[model samples]
Target chain A: MDKGIDRRDFLKLIGIGGALIVMDTGRLAGAADNKMAQDTLSFIQLSDTHWGFNDPKINPDFAGTLRKAIAQINSMKSQPDFIIFSGDVTHTTDDPKERRRRMGEAREIIGGLRLKNVKMMPGEHDAGLDNGEAFQEYFGTTHYTFQQKDVNFIVVDNASDSTSSIGDTQLQWLSAEMEKLDKDSRIVVFTHRPLFELYPQWDWWTRDGAKAIDILMPYKNVVVFYGHIHQEHHHMTGHIAHHAARGMLFPLPAPGSVPKRVQIPWDNDQPYKGVGYRSAVPKKDAYGYDLTEFPIIKV
Target chain B: MTNIKYLLRIMVVISAVVLAFAWVHIARLAAETQTVQNPVANQGHEQVIKITVKRFDYTPNKIRLKKGVAVTLVFTSLDRTHGFNCPGLGVRTDIVPGKSNTLRIVPQKAGRYEFSCDVFCGDGHEDMSGEIIVED
Candidate 1:
């Protein structure tokens, strides 16, 4: 993957502030190399593991469910370039030590996957407990950006606050990051909560999401993949396509379809019903991606 | 003698009127404090607490249950999906619109237990929590 560009040059291009024109040149070059990067540019997303959650009626073996999900991803016909756990890595608790232990257990289980480049963001369950210290301890910065096949993947933490906001600091960083790219750059944003107002009554909307949306309005192709509602949903915010993924733990009722957010119960026969993940492939010479849903393998 | 008789008669009438007013006040107080047994508690379903969760709040957000009684929480969402997560009780349920979710819990200890919506349903998801108060 390392062409002639050294580490310094690569960093200088992707870096913000002083790194604008260089990034533009690199992006132009990236356009030519995108065809070769397309095949291996696909990635998998699994979310709402709720590792510490245990309930006989809903999901008794939460960890086991995640293992089966990993098995499914590992046994895929082709490996994805990376895997991203959108958020809610573990169920939040008042005990910080217990939360850390759950995070450790989740890491050990997720580590069993074949892919090495796994990135994670925090759902409210992981961040809202201790204000994201435990989550940051396991997974570095909650919000960050990386490039793969000319597509920029921006992962941010909006669950740190009960209001589901990206905070002023993260918002500033997001704007700065967006400034480094041209309007035509393919940007895929991964967040724990829906950036748009999916349903405010149920706390499905980000408090300060419009600010971030306003910043990205100038961009031609901005797709968002979020996990919180634990269902397969798609929305359009200007040019951006917001898609929410299914959870690994349990699925919830659709927005406005239910009065409260409750887990969908498993059938007597099919216990793993409605439990699944998704894989996405960024299209070449375009700003959108194709998504495919895969259900968890039955035990 | 006639004047004395008349004075006694007037005093008796006033006493009777005062007594009648006191009786009515007492009756009203009794009615106000009367514990109308929640029909849900007596359904022979062991334990049941029907909770209605809506966009911004949960109906009966403060539940007082008898300690050591097994309780089933019948949760329903009125607007959108809301989570009923009680970490202390190790109970979590989703209240979906148009349907009901049930959670069974037995409170062995008398204490305050808090629960909230774990799922992000909207901007107010954080404040969308309730508490269960158990009494001995």
Candidate 2:
């Protein structure tokens, strides 16, 4: 409860606490409100690592950036309960062999983290063309829901499909899943692309996301965390909070902010300027979680 | 067994009546012969088509052309890096933003061919594609 302990320090502090709590990722999303403790529960969300991507102008040190992120997470005084990689774990490659190689390298890099409980979703780059074949082969299911304490974490696969949609089957699955949760439950949804339309012109919006939004409208507290756009963005639809995290590889200009959707030029002096990760802790009683972004800065 | 046989006979009769009606209509239509014109003839011999590649879609999703005529595609992207690849036609070009890439062809045959974006622009990259229709 030290006010001086920022999120980064807080994560380092959490690791020292006793007992490795293994909560069900399922109950983590739908059924664990009663288990909510007075203390806040926190976790890290990292996205768009773009492993194996070789763009010197945008991010020449892409591999080093990831390694640095893992180092930061590992050096924490206390470790988060789990870490969630929102999507785009690997950059796109038409060669299936290269794609698998990138996935393996990404897995090996992320394996360095002290936290063992890791959850992942897909970025369109990972699953879009292959319909999640390569991603599923490496990361398992594209969509699922889990629970931790009083919070519900729903991870849907909107990236693997070219339409950038949570397919009809996953949409129906979401609706049916919401039926089982209380209207007052705190729900956190994670996907690779924004669940609500951020900017359709840049392919930022999911085609049928409104259907998923409609299903969650009844819920009192709902927040979405996604990562396709490659920058930090916050938008609200009704009571739902939608947040896009900063990608680990590079940043893209805001919607229509530029003439085209190009990577923000890397600051020569500042290498990993706008790229980083985020952490959130639950609020009292199931209202919502407080969020903080930690950018990777040079020492 | 008898009831099943009767039902089959009724179905066969109904099909026969439907076929007879279709035959009469065809016979009457055949008697009313009309001249059909080739629309491609009016479209000129050489054609220029511009395609703007956005995130996951091509502005001109379908391009119409006359067989054995020159067609030029002036391709540019409104967004990130995209590629145009038509394997059947052996045509591939990179569509970069702020620049135009042209692919020219004179299709020798009348048929439909597809072109796709092979570059990884974003999550919707796979969905970016268009078609070419050559009319005889």
Candidate 3:
């Protein structure tokens, strides 16, 4: 695998978006790195585009950045089976008209991609204020499950409630869903916020995520990918692997790294610093997923 | 011998009664203090209370004040950054590192208010919480 050999000059040689990274997640904590699944499907995970956010210092070219990423993925030789946008498709706004406008613009931009199978969930910014009203108009459902290549893909809606809770009723729904799956079934969970308390004070945690984790614990093979931290973070809750994606907009600092949880200063020298997306391809046995972090398309 | 034993028993009973009276008196004084907050402050004077916060706790974990009284809550961080968030009182302020952050709050009602450092301190950040008791 090209990822096996960490060529220092490889990234520079290929330029920004020509990244082909294949990380065998076996080395990641709680990731078994079991024999790769043969019949498993591959998909792209990107998050937090914040479509309507306007900050010149943070990202003056917000629309351009989103367009470029979509264009680059479309140009890929081999397309992913599907793509999942974890959350925050649009930035939060108090104005109802402006909120719908942003979602409409986001829908237009994302439609440029070559693939048709796209799954999206709302983030606190997109749905917290009106409880997924605008997002539902653009996208179909807040939370639902789909199966692809024998993998049960569960989308949990934790951002619909502004209070950062999955709620008890949704928890029961998740519990009932888990009862139908086999202990050895391959599961991939997509949500907006980290299911565990990565950092509660910064709103980086779900209020009742612990209960959701408790439900998923019975399964031997499970992984979670979420976006809200605005930077890539990998964590382990029991044997489950939870990975946070780098936001499509500007990136925020590490959890509690500074007095304020603000965006890292943008440098004209490194405009695309700390922004990227990931691709997860299953190995032969499909017991685990290997992630590839691709840099933002040069705009 | 019987008179001596009776006298000893009477002495024990007297000691128990005296201790019980003292306990009741102390309890009443504490209750009065809680209701009164700090009676030393004269009218129209703003109560100034300085508090410091560290890793996972506030030094003065509880603050007592009287209703309709304005208080200047002076806050400082002994180590890194922290916050004082009393949603019940509609007051929020950050505790700057090596600096003093202050907020003035006037309690309109008598009740218990909860506050915590909103900044992500560490694993035990949730523990860095306290209460504000406003008395009528």
User: lDDT tens digits, residues B24-45, model 2?
Assistant: 9998776554212221222255
By DockQ, who's the top model here?
Answer: 1
- CA lDDT of every candidate: 0.77, 0.75, 0.78
For candidate 1, write residues B5-124 as lDDT tens digits: 999999999999999999999998876664343425545758677888886688878898888888888888877666776756766666778886999888888887766675555434
Docking quality of model 3: it rates as incorrect
**lDDT, candidate 1, at B101:** 92
For candidate 2, the per-residue lDDT at A68 reads: 79
What ranges in model 2 sit over 4 Å off?
A1-38, B1-136
Chain A TM-scores, all candidates?
0.85, 0.86, 0.87
The C-alpha stretches of model 1 lying farther than 4 A from their native spots are: A1-40, B1-136
Q: What TM-score would chain B receive for each of the candidates shown?
A: 0.68, 0.65, 0.67
Interface RMSD of 2: 8.1
Q: Which of the numbered candidates is closest to the native, going by highest lDDT?
A: 3
Candidate 2 docking classification: incorrect
lDDT digits (tens) for residues A1-299 of candidate 2? 21333333433443432233112211232122222222557788999998988878888786698897887666554456679999989988878898899998888888888778999888877876688898888888988989987788888888776655678998999998899899988889897887786765456777678998999999988998889888889999999989899999888887767545667878876567679887777766556666666656343
Q: What is the Å distance of residue B130 in model 2 from its true position?
A: 14
